[model samples]
Target: MAARERLADDPSITFPGFFDDTAVQTDADGGVVELTGALLRAVEVAADDFLGPQDANTLCVDRHESHRYRVVRRQGIIFIRIDEDPRACGLTVPALHSGAQYAIGSDGRILRRLRDGEPDGSLAPTDAGSGIPVPTSEVGRSFEAPDGAVPLPF
Candidate 1:
């Protein structure tokens, strides 16, 4: 039966808290517990498992204040990208990354990193579309960033 098959495939899952170097207060006696480096790393590993396979196309987090962050997987990997106005100093940039280990900055700058044993600057952006993936503001028309900004290819 389809239901039987689904149940068979589903496995038990556990979730680890994702708070590194974060302090926790104990209700009893107002005790404070601080997560150190090792504990933090362990938490990260455990959190990864709970978050599901890295190959998952999407990962979302919703908070109490209606603040939500969605980490979408493009191919496999995900990077924390920070983007902001190039001229702004105190910028509240969003961290968005594709599975390619690359990021898009709020300032419209693209960030890429090379893997181990490889040259850092050797990475190149092949034109997935007709041309490069930069937004254009010509003819004085309303516009948004180029489609390249999206994780999914157009």
Candidate 2:
């Protein structure tokens, strides 16, 4: 969606002016910024992305030409597990990985690059006091221990 059309979707959402040409930006308080127009189009997307109950496969943000992404939320952090290109998310250099998981402060700044996530979307994320609470999804919540090759408790 065009920026103007996105602006029409939700007029209240304000993207930080820090996004110049690239998405990687540093906030005023020394926080790192990730996920810009390249990853998620804040305007064109609906309010659900911001305030929706994320599931096993949830759309993070649209990038470039409305690329949908599946995300992971753990330890109070959001991780991009998959992209439209089928490349892995949240690992290595952005150029090498095509696109990596995005991190941002609740106040509209980028969170510091902590570490790269695993292939199965295991991010090893930490709790940074961004004030945005990420609840544990039902996807892996049922698994208590492995019953042989089975990954679930049942």
Separate clash counts for every candidate: 5, 4
Over 4 Å off, model 1: 1-33, 53-57, 61-154
lDDT (C-alpha, whole model) for all candidates: 0.30, 0.35
Could you tell me how far off, in angstroms, the CA of residue 58 lies in candidate 1 after the best superposition?
A: 3.1
Residue pair clashes in candidate 1: 77-99, 81-95, 83-105, 83-106, 84-106
Q: How well is each residue in 1-154 modelled by candidate 2, as lDDT tens digits?
A: 3222222222222222232334432335878656556234322132223323445565433233223334333344333322333233443324334333343333223332221242423234578767865466754575455567765536
Which is the leading candidate under lDDT?
2
